[model samples]
Target: EPEVTQTPSHQVTQMGQEVILRCVPISNHLYFYWYRQILGQKVEFLVSFYNNEISEKSEIFDDQFSVERPDGSNFTLKIRSTKLEDSAMYFCASSRTGNSGNTIYFGEGSWLTVV
Candidate 1:
């Protein structure tokens, strides 16, 4: 089975700094998403992209955050002016379709620590 992959498994950055997390989702998947878990908190959806546009985004996905599919296989998430509250395990996920029943494969996760 194919799996999502991420780069820089862990990172430490100071507050107000910019951070970019990279991912390569399952090649055949059509829907891509970004989710974050702040330490012990439940996983929270940030945004979803499809057909080269944003399909949906949660409140947590503010101006400070951006997503891009820079190429055929690369998906990236950039956080501008990071804050302590932004620290979390960022998961990149993808599914063949947006249907709720479809399985969404997730990357191991990129851990971000804001100082």
Candidate 2:
């Protein structure tokens, strides 16, 4: 089975810098999303994209954050400015159907660290 792929598995940046995490979910999946885990914290939802638009986003997705699907098969998450608190493992996920019955596939995760 095809799986989600993420580039630059790890990143290091200074506070106030910008970072971009890339992901490519299988072409068969339609809805794509970005999630994060702050070390020991639970997986947190960041944003949901469908039809090239943002369907939903959590409060954590503040003004400093943005997401894009420049290519139909690839999705990207951008942080306008990085913060020490922003250090976390970001995950790319996708689901063929956005229904309760369908399951989503998640990427390994992109680790981001800020100094």
Candidate 3:
């Protein structure tokens, strides 16, 4: 079965730099999401995209964060002016639908470290 795949499995950046994490979600899925887990924290939802626009977003998805489906297949998460607290394992996920009964598939995650 197809699964979400992320690029640059690990990344380290300066405190004020920008970071872009790339992902290719399962091809047939319609709803895409971005979630993150700080080293010792729970997985937190950041944003969800559908129909090429943000469908929902959590407070953690502040102005510094952005998501884009630049191509028909690739999904991306960008963190601007990164901070130490922004370091985490960012997961790319997708599901056929947004309904509760749908199964959400997640990528292994792209680890980000900000100095």
Per-candidate TM vs. native? 0.97, 0.97, 0.98
Candidates' C-alpha lDDT: 0.96, 0.94, 0.97
How accurate locally is residue 1 in candidate 1, as Cα lDDT from 0 to 100? Answer: 76
Q: Which runs of model 1 end up more than 4 angstroms from their true locations?
A: none
Task: Please list all clashing residue pairs in model 1, or write none if there are none.
Answer: none
User: What lDDT is reached at residue 32 by model 3?
Assistant: 98
Model 1 vs. true fold: TM: 0.97
What 10-residue stretch in candidate 1 is worst by lDDT? 1-10
Each prediction's Cα RMSD?
0.7, 0.7, 0.6
lDDT of 3: 0.97
Candidate 1, 1-110: lDDT as tens digits: 79999987999999999999999999999999999999999999999999999999999999999999999999999999999999999999999999879999999999
Better of 1 and 3 by TM-score: 3
TM-score of 2: 0.97
lDDT (Cα, tens digit) per residue for candidate 2, span 78-109:
99779999999999999999999998999999
Q: How many backbone clashes does candidate 3 have?
A: 0
